[model samples]
Target: MPRIIDSNDKNLIGDKVKALRKAKKMSQQTLSDRLETMAIYVCRGSISRIEDKSRTVTDIELYGISKVLETPIESFFES
Candidate 1:
């Protein structure tokens, strides 16, 4: 199923993903490595773009990030 995400959700999700990545002490390259192993093709540049709210990430990418961060998908939208 497709994840229905609003524009506001993009910034929120980006912030949370960035925060989780930081908490894990992982660089965007490391995160990209994990995603690549999961068959997701997000690059370090893409990660930066997403985290900076400069790009709208796809649900598939979000799923990959959720797995990398060990977080649930809904957590991206949580307050």
Candidate 2:
């Protein structure tokens, strides 16, 4: 089965990512560098866009990010 995530869900997830990164004292550039080492080409602008609810991140990208951030996908949804 295919998983479908809407834009609002993406935004919620993105918000969580941003909050987590901040809590970890990481900047967007630092996160981008980590993603780069994982072969994920995401720029700081993209991260900012995602955090600002201006971009819809793909599931694969989100998975990669979750791993790099040392966080589980469920963490992004835990309110």
Candidate 3:
């Protein structure tokens, strides 16, 4: 059987990421630049999609985000 994902939870992490980014007073472009510095080539639009929960983030990308934001992956998933 296929595992069903929760609709509400789909955006939880993304929302958290957005919140953290905003709390840091950082812009999406800066985040993208940081990701690039870490060799993660996610564009600004992709970041936007991520913040809005329209895009699914990969493990590597998540790692990059965690590192850049100085936040743990667990924090991103916390509701």
RMSD, every candidate, angstroms: 4.1, 3.5, 1.9
Point out the worst 10-residue segment of candidate 3 by lDDT.
Answer: 2-11
lDDT of each: 0.87, 0.84, 0.88
Please identify model 3 stretches exceeding 4 Å from their true place: 1-3, 6-12
For all candidates, what are the clash counts?
A: 0, 0, 0
Query: RMSD to the native, candidate 2?
Result: 3.5
Model 3: pairs clashing at backbone N, Cα or C within 3 Å: none
Candidate 2 segments whose C-alpha is farther than 4 A from its true place:
1-10
Candidate 2 vs candidate 3: which has greater TM-score?
3
**Model 2 lDDT per residue over 1-79, tens place:** 6447543444667788888899889999999999888888889999998888788777877987898889998888799
Runs with alpha carbons beyond 4 Å of true place in candidate 1: 1-11
> Estimated TM-score per prediction?
0.84, 0.82, 0.88
Please write out the lDDT profile of model 3 over residues 1-79, one tens digit for every residue: 7537756443456888899999999999999999999999999999998999888888999999999999988988777
| Superposition TM-score, candidate 2 onto the true structure | 0.82
37 Cα displacement, candidate 3 (Å): 0.5
